[model samples]
Target: MALLFWAVGVLAYLVAVFHRQSLSVAGLDAAERMGVSEAGMATLAMLQLLVYALMQVPVGVLLDRFGSKRLLLTGALTMAAGQLVFALSDNLLYGIAARMLIGLGDAMTFISVVRLVNLAFPPHRNPLLLQLTGLIGQLGAIASTVPMIASLHTYGWAPTFYGAAGVGVVMAVLLIAVLRDKPSGQAAEPGLKAAWTHPGTRLGMWTHVATQCSAAAFLLLWGYPFLVEGQGLAPQTAGVLLATLTAVGMVCGPVLGYLAGRYPLRRSWLVLGVIGSTAAAWTAVLAWPGHAPLWLLVVLVVVLAANGPGSMIGFDYARTFNPAGRIGAATGIVNGGGFLASMSVIALIAIGLEVFDDYRLAFLLQYPVWLLGVVQVLRYRAKARRLLAQLDEGLGEVRGAQEPALGTKALD
Candidate 1:
């Protein structure tokens, strides 16, 4: 059962990631065909990400209320419609709308897959499993660059999208047949209210961590390109570098997960992650333009690779606080916050650059974002430790109080 679930999750993600990278490439082709400007094309790309971020909350809710199977099917259909729209639509507006649909569908795939893996695997194995998932997803990205370019040249963007949509449908069907709502003997109909209303759930899912994480992720995705573009590198080189980042992250993810499991101290790891990420960002700044040496490129790759650890830490944080049977919502909230932040980062950077075309300035502005994330994670760690101490003391009192009740019940 675990193997079956794992396979489904991997294959589905492979298709989704491939489709995602394919769209960006296709968008360029389509944009050229339509004579859209670079800025206009950028806006279209941002729109898809923004919509994806916006849908995270609702997608998470649907996954929580209904099982992943139904939502997966719905997402797949919506995604297919979006692709069909993109492939066939004549106007930019239609393309935008199609991208929106794709975002909606694509957003559902990540959290759903995470939740499904969480359900399928044992607790200790979750991080490694997620890393493996991340690795597979990276292939989708890796394909996007040279590989996708090659595929596009041979097949054209239209056939490529059509083929992707076909794969999405097949994945949806497999999801329907293989996926389960919950493990056997677990609650068949767990109330959403009961599962989601706890203090931990409310705080972790709704506030603090989710938003910060979202912002950081968004910064990485949208901000990185702008940073490179600002440095005067060709889009192809930037894209290659971006792909390298994901590739390293994919390889490092499992290793980090393994270390995280060994340490079992989330706070220390988060501190280290913050340090590494900060260093990486600064390294990126230093390596800008002609300064980008081979050694620095390797450094960027390793630093960018730290995203794996950062993500694992985020997942660990979510799992600790998420109420049982509510992993989907928790996963959604966590990812949603990151995506929302991403939307904001992309927008804010665009605005900043308009005034002062300085990529370094934008990069400098983003350091505080990573620092903020580190601080928040640290605060969470401190508060969690305190709460656990309180709980332990409270348990002691309860046990003391319970002995008398037990004796009385025995007498009765």
Candidate 2:
């Protein structure tokens, strides 16, 4: 029964991710249909991410208030409404609104799923389960790349989007039927004030920012256009490459999850390694004289894909440090890190594209952010470890006190 309910939450998360990435996979159809420029199309994506980033705290608060089941139900229904609007609208304003709705709904799903994982699973299993959530959620991204494009070509705009909306509604219904907010009785409302003060929560946030910003920015908006328009790849080929990002992510998620699980104390090292590799990969691409080789791009995407799971390290931080009641809030703060970073990078990339007229140079703008995130992750990681150590010592002292006196003589 526990497994069944948890599966529902994960499945709902998968669907939410599918909706989130839907616009990316629309091929050229989105712009052509809406008669929007690249920047205009980017507006659709940027605003969506902007909304998703902005909503984290509020959504976190709401989840704590209402519990996971209601939020899951509401999130699904909201995404359904967004997709329906997306299907029917042809103009920019409505398209923007639709994407915002999707963003709002998307924001509600992942953290809620993480919260459910905490409620339903054993403590030791969390890192693995969290990684597994990221792994499976990426399947949604893969679908958006291949099957989504297929649907767009076959059925055309309204039908494809309507089909997506239909899935959202079905997902919502499933959540309504299956989701359990707690193990037994009601859960406590988290103190937002307390959640904000925890060093672990901040560590989680910076970890997310360090690891995810680049990958999120690339996959969510810029990568497709950079391939098709900038690097001059065929859309068909670009779609395949984009799909590969998710594929690599699915592969890497388990590995990272296992590693994080095995050496929970060293989770930050895993994140830093992934982040370093990501920076190196992007550096190679940006410094290439002409268009990067296909193999090189492939390698870069693989590294970028790892960050998706790498970013999950943030939630692991939050989950480890936070009390169960505050999980939602902590998760929200951690989750927001990447998207906010992403939003900033996307804007800078847009500017670079306009001013420099080179994709490589435009992408170079991310380097400073990489530096910033790395420093902060190191700082907070140290703090989190210290705090965790202090906590363990305190608990150990209490346990020692609770132990029976050795004998009156020994006790004396």
Candidate 3:
């Protein structure tokens, strides 16, 4: 029964990913449909993420208060409605509104699913399950790469979005029929304040910010355009490359998950490695005189692929630092970090592209963010270690007091 519920929740996440990527797959067509330039088209995705980032904390709080079942169903129906509006409408305002709705639903998904896993599975299994859920969820993204692009040519726009919306509607019904929250049935405390107050939660947010946003920006909005327009790859070839990114992510997730689980205290090292290597890869590609060689581009995408899994380390921090009661809010705070970074970089890229008409220059906008985030991640890691030291010292003192004084005497 637990497995069944988790699967159902994962299935909903898969659909949510599909809906999120659907617009990106239809990039040129969507631009044509909306009659917007590149900057304008970026807004569609940008606004969705803006909404998603804004809602994370609130959604996290709601998930804790209400449980996963209601949140999941509400999310699905909301996304479906967004898709419905998107499918039938040709107007730009309607399209933006639809994407906003999709972002609302998307915000509620992964954290809820993570919370569900915490509830349904044992602590030891949570890391593996979380990694698996994320890797498998990429299958939806993988589908969007080639198949979604093909669908646009075959059936046209309206039907494609309509079908995507239909999946959400179906998932909502399934959730109603099959989903169950944790069995404890214990009432949740109002823990948002405590969750926010924890320095570790803030550390988790910086870890997320440091690791995730580069990949998010590339895969979500800019990668396709940069490949096709900047690098001179054909659309079909670029789609294949993007799909490879997802495949590589699926392969790396388990390895990262294992390392994280094995070395809980040193997980930030994994994040630093990812960020450093991603920086290295991007430097090689962006600084290349022209379009980078195929091999270097491959390396760049492969390194970038690790970020998807790398970002999950943030949630691990949240789980490790907070009580289970506050995990939802902590998860939300951590989850918001990457999107916030992505949102900032996306806007910067759009502005850079407009000003310089250069993709390389535009991508360099990420460097400052990367530098700033690394400093914060290191600072917080030290803070978390100090926190752990204080906790251990307190525990030792408690133990010493409980035991009889060594020379003084035994307790009466």
Candidate 4:
């Protein structure tokens, strides 16, 4: 039963991810159809992210109040409407509005699904389930690559997006029928203050910011163009690379999950490792004298693939520290970190591209954001660890006292 519920939640999240990443493969076509410049296209992606980031706290509050079922259903319908509008749009303004709607809907999904996972699964099972959720959800991104590109080429724009929107509507109907808020009479706390007060939440947020933004920026809008135009790869080859990015992430998700479960104390180290690897990979590609070799590009893609799973570590921090009632808001706050960072990177890259006409220059902007995030992660990791130690000491004392009372009762 738990698996069945989780599967449905995962399906909704999968569809949401597909909608989120659909624009990735369609960048050039969207530019052509909307008759917009690269910066203009970036605006579409940036605005979507902005909307998504801005909505996280509010949506978290709503999720706590209404439960995952209501939020998931609404999210699906909203995304379906946005995709329909985007499909029919012929100008930049309409595209912006459509993307905004899509962003709004996208904002409601992953956190809700996460809440569902928390409700349906056992505590020990959550880390693996969460990773599996991400792994399966990334299949949506994989679909958005070659399959989406092929669809755009075969059926053109409107019809393809119309089909995409139709999928969302169907998911909405399924959610109405099958999804539930909790197993039975589960209660949720509705305060954001408690979640926000914890150092672990902040640590998770910074971890997310550090780990996720670069990959999000790449996969969201810039990567395909960077590959095709900058590195001079063929469109087909670029699509394959993008697909490989998703595939690699899918492969890494479980391994990271296992590591996270086994080495909860060392999770921060794992995040730092992923960040270092990402920075190294990007530096190698961007600093290469000319077009990087295909193998080097492959290595870069493989490294970027770790970002998504690494970011999931942030959520584990939130889950570890917060009470059940506060999980939704805490997850929202952590989720916002990456998107907020990605928004800045996306916007800056857009401006850089417009100003310098160089992908290398645009991507260089990722480093500062990364540096800032790494610093914060270190700062908050220390604070969170201190808090956790105190918590453990307090818990030990309580258990120590209770053990004496139980022993006396047994002896009597």
Candidate 5:
């Protein structure tokens, strides 16, 4: 049953992920057809992300109250409806509404899966399981790239989106049929009061949401532009490159999970800081007009790969401290925070590019933001370590007392 649930979670993630990437492709096409400015397109992206981020907390709460299966069904249906609107629309307002729906519908899959994995697996196995699941979802991103561009080329964006909408309905049906809220014999309602009341968990959740939000913003401002314009890669090449970024992430996910498992959070962040800094610097160098040599694009692709895992480590850190029963809500909070940060940054950058008329400089400026986030993560890690040490000492004292009691009972 656990394995079955895991499979369902993977499928749910795939469906949500497919919709997420499809939008980027469709949005790019829409902008091209409408003669929209870079800033305008980014503004549209801002809408999509803002709605998505804003919905995370509420969605998390819903998942906790209503259960994963029901929420998953809702997400699937909502996404399909959003795509239908997107397929039919010709203007930005319609596009905005469609993207908003996509964001809302997209909310349920990833966070819910994290909760499901937490429930289905043991504590020690969770980090790896999440990393594994991330890999599966990356495949969805991959599909969006070359495969999506090919579809868009062959049938046009409208048809592709409509087809995706049909797929969404199928996914909704599957969720309604098979997914379950809790495993048998572990049945107990996960109450809203208890889930919402934990201060540490709530803080941890917001921390995650902020971090991921920032990462998303950074990726859009710097990474997406570099691929679309700076490199002057065709849409198909850009899509393939996009796919490569996530595909490499699939590798980084498990490797980082192993590192988190082996070392403490602070140590892991220090290493990530170094790697992410290198990635940022290298990406900047590659993105610099005529500065990047022949191999620069390849190097940038590798760096782009690190972005996904960089955020995942923060998420792993959050999960470590979360209360067992509140894991779903906690995951939602963390995810929401990260995405919210991303939306804010994307909106700001979109505004900046219009004013400055130079995207490369605007994009380079965003790199420092990630470095700053890394510092925050390091600080959080140090604080977590101190707290954990205190917890260990307290647990040791309890164990020491219990050991003597057990020995005395043996003598009797």
Candidate 6:
């Protein structure tokens, strides 16, 4: 029964991810159809992500109040509507509005699915389940890559997006029929104040910011262009490389999940490792004298694969540190951190490209964002660890006092 519920929620999330990333394969086409410049193209993505980032806290609050079933249903319908709008749009303003609608709906998805995971699964199983959720959800991204590109070429833009929107409607029907708020006895959690106040939540948010923004920025908009135009790969080859990013992420998700489960205290180290590796990979590619060798580009894609799973570690932090009542809000804040950073990176890169006329220089902008995020992660790591130690100490004392009472009761 738990698996059934989780599967349904995951399906909804999968479609949401598909909607979120569908634009990735269509960046060039979108710009052409809308008759917009590169910066204008970036605006469509930026505005969408901006709406998603801005809505996270509110969506979290709403999830706590209304439950995952309702949120999932509504989000599915909203995304479907947004996609339909996008399919029909022929101008920049209409496209921007459509993308924003998609963003608004996309904002409501993963967090709600996450809450469903918590409600349906036991605590000990959550880390693995979370990773699995991400792993599977990325199939949507994979679909959006080579396959979506093919679809666009074969079926044309409006039909391809119309089909994408149709998937959302189907998922909505499934949610309405099969999804539930929780098992019979479970109650909803409430309150964002506690979630916001916790150091661990902040740590998680920074972890997300550090780990996720680069990959998110890459996959969502810039990567295809970088591969095709900057690296001088054929469009087909670029699509394959973009698909490789998602496939590699799928492979890494479970391994990272196992590591996270086995070494909860060391999760941040994994995040740091991903951040450092990503920086090194980008430096290698961007600093290469000319178009980087395909192997070097492949190496960069492989490293970027870790970012999505590493971002999941942030949610693990939220789940472990906060009470059930605050999980939604805490997760929201953490989730928002990545998108907000991604949005900024996208905007900066767009501006950089417009100003510099060079992908290499524009890509350099990711460094400052990384530096800022790494500092926050380190700062919050210490604070969160201290708080966790104090919490453990207090818990040990409480358990110590209760053990003897339980022992006496057992004798009685």
lDDT of 4: 0.85
Per-residue lDDT over 1-412 for candidate 3, one digit per residue giving the tens place of the 0 to 100 score: 9899899989888888887777766777888888887788788889999999989888876776688888888899999999999887676898899999999999988878988888887766677778889988999888878998887789999998888888899999999999988434444446677877776777788888988888888888888999988998888888988899989999999888878655554677888899999999999999899888888888888998999899888877777667777777788888887798888888888888999899999999999998998898877766656766656422111111222211201000
Residue 260 of candidate 4: its Cα lDDT? Answer: 69
Of 3 and 6, which scores higher on TM-score? Answer: 6
Model 2, range 1-412, lDDT digits (tens) per residue?
Answer: 7778778888988998899989876735778888987667778888898899888878777766677788888889999999999999888999999999999999988888877777677765666677778888888888788788788878889999999999999998788777777433333344566766877678788888888888887778788888887778887788899999999989988888777655554677788898899999998887888888899989989899898889887776676556667777778878877798888888888788778888888989999888999888777756655765555422111111223312211100
User: Which residues of candidate 2, in runs, are more than 4 Å off?
Assistant: 182-190, 385-412
Stretches > 4 Å off in candidate 1: 23-39, 176-239, 266-268, 271-276, 283-291, 393-412
Q: Say which prediction, candidate 5 or candidate 6, comes out ahead on TM-score.
A: 6
Compared with the true structure, all predictions reach lDDT values of 0.58, 0.79, 0.81, 0.85, 0.64, 0.85
Q: Could you tell me which 10 consecutive residues in candidate 3 have the lowest summed lDDT?
A: 403-412
Among residues 3 or more apart in sequence or in different chains, the pairs in candidate 3 whose N, CA or C atoms overlap within 3 Å are: none
**TM-score of every model versus the real structure:** 0.78, 0.90, 0.92, 0.92, 0.83, 0.93
* Number of residue pairs clashing in candidate 1, backbone atoms closer than 3 angstroms, sequence gap of 3 or more or interchain: 4
In the predicted model 2, the residue pairs found to clash are none
Evaluated at residue 216, the lDDT of candidate 4 is: 94
C-alpha lDDT (0 to 100) for residue 57 of candidate 2: 79
CA RMSD per model (angstroms): 7.3, 5.7, 5.9, 5.5, 6.4, 5.5
Alpha carbon deviation, residue 312, candidate 5 (Å): 1.8
Model 1 error, position 394 (Å): 11
Candidate 1 lDDT, tens digit per residue, 290-323? 5566556556555665654455455554565544
Q: Which ten residues in a row have the lowest lDDT in candidate 2?
A: 393-402
> Which candidate would rank higher by lDDT, 1 or 5?
5
lDDT for each residue of candidate 6 in 1-412, tens digit (9 for 90 to 100): 8899899988888898999999888999999999998899899999999999999999887777778888889999999999999999999988998899899989999998888877777665666677788899999999889989999999999999999899999999999999877423323334577788887789889999989999998999999999999999999999999899999999989888777655544677888899999999999999999899999999999999999999988887777666677778889899998899999999999999999999999999999999998898888877765765555522111111211111111100
Clash-forming residue pairs, model 4: 189-325
Give me the runs in candidate 6 sitting further than 4 Å from their true place: 182-190, 388-412
How many clashing residue pairs are found in candidate 2? Answer: 0
Tens digits of per-residue lDDT for model 5 on 82-197?
98988887877887788888888888778778878877777656767777888887777767667777888899878988998998999988887787775333322363355444
Tens digit per residue, CA lDDT, model 4, 1-412: 7788789989999999999999988999999998999999999999999999999988887776678888889999999999999999999999999999999999999988888877776665676778888999999899889999999989999999999999999999999888766433333444578788887789889989999999998899999999999999999999999999999999888888778666555777899999999999999999999999999999999999999999998887777666667778889889987799999999989989988999999899899988998898888867765765555522111111211211111100
In terms of lDDT, which candidate is strongest?
A: 4
lDDT of 3 at 252: 93
